[model samples]
Target chain A: MGEVKHILLAKFKDDVSQEQIDLLIKGYANLVNHVEPMKSFRWGKDVSVENLHQGFTHVFESSFETTEGIATYISHPAHVEFADSFLAQLDKVLVVDYKPTAVEP
Target chain B: MGEVKHILLAKFKDDVSQEQIDLLIKGYANLVNHVEPMKSFRWGKDVSVENLHQGFTHVFESSFETTEGIATYISHPAHVEFADSFLAQLDKVLVVDYKPTAVEP
Candidate 1:
């Protein structure tokens, strides 16, 4: 019931354009204004030099104060709209969540 | 130049036991004590009810105050020891790092 961190990893479809990817990134950042329970959100392209990435190239992370806050953020209309539109452009996606007892301030 | 978040998504080899996973998780947390630049580390197994996870089932996230801090953490002996020993038990691993303009306290 404490703070929960949500991490999302995605690989865009091979044919997706750079412009579309830019839009999606901007769209996600804008959600902070609309989703009240979303305490923070940060995202970026993979920058690891390690050859271990496989095909995933992007990661987005957000934190919520509670489990219900996460549920609310997931079902929020803005989030749903963005996901509905972006899913087709993504070849793969991975979602993981956890409640951390120790977090950086 | 700012806060960087590193997220790793991985799937263990089918035969790996839960005990090993628990050990790896504890090992990462211990790095925060041994590695000076690793500001925080939090990890957990996948808990999403969504079907989008594919074959990945675990994630670990850590934050560093700068790019150099990240490099230090990656090359730290404790991190290297853990990664070297566990690489054989992992089927897939994805590493992503980004500098966030905004982060939750």
Candidate 2:
């Protein structure tokens, strides 16, 4: 199996400003340094105007070498602190992790 | 100004078998050839034991060269037909799109 990819989709609380979200995104980016299992991290704000999004406006994704790596990242103090401190600012969150499979395209 | 990523998370309906889902996934993989704007596609079954997934069991993501490319893909007949055919088998669906941005670790 390929490496596991952890995906997070979030809609910030109504009062959270764009500036705050930007800073939080940077904080997540820095998590790679604090969490040894974090292989790479990337994030962005939703740009699609499709009504299908259901209000989700931001997404963050990280790659881990294995499922154990995912567990380590989840249990890391930095990740826990980040979630504990800012989770209240999120209105909705959708998280899913998957391992890539070969597919012709 | 980086490429836009279109992410999809879904859980199949109670009656949908894994074999059916696999066929649908392969059908999706073929969309890249039918839809000119589709740059690349990847998908996988969810592997997280984290209760945070909220029952979302599969994810498919595709990268587009531009926001316009996304627009084209959305309006393509192949995409529309696929969604119309398989959407009824999805119990829950979450879709999000975002444009990549550089950030330091």
Clash-forming residue pairs, model 1: none
Q: How many collisions between residues are there in candidate 1?
A: 0
Q: Write model 1 residue lDDT over B1-105, tens digit each, in one string.
A: 468887777889999999987776777678889899988887767666566666778877788897788888878888899889777788988787876654323
Q: How close is candidate 1 to the true structure, as a TM-score?
A: 0.82
Locate the minimum summed-lDDT window of 10 residues in model 1 chain A: A96-105
The TM-scores of all predictions, comma-separated, are 0.82, 0.93
Q: After superposition, how far is residue A7 of candidate 2 from its true place, in Å?
A: 0.7
**Winning candidate number (lDDT):** 2
All models: lDDT? 0.79, 0.86
- The reply for model 1, stretches above 4 Å from the true place, is A103-105, B102-105
Backbone clash count for every predicted candidate, in the order shown = 0, 0
lDDT string for model 2 (B1-105, tens) is 358999988889999988998889988889988999897888988888767788988899999988899888888999999988778889988788888776964
What would you estimate as the lDDT of candidate 2?
Answer: 0.86
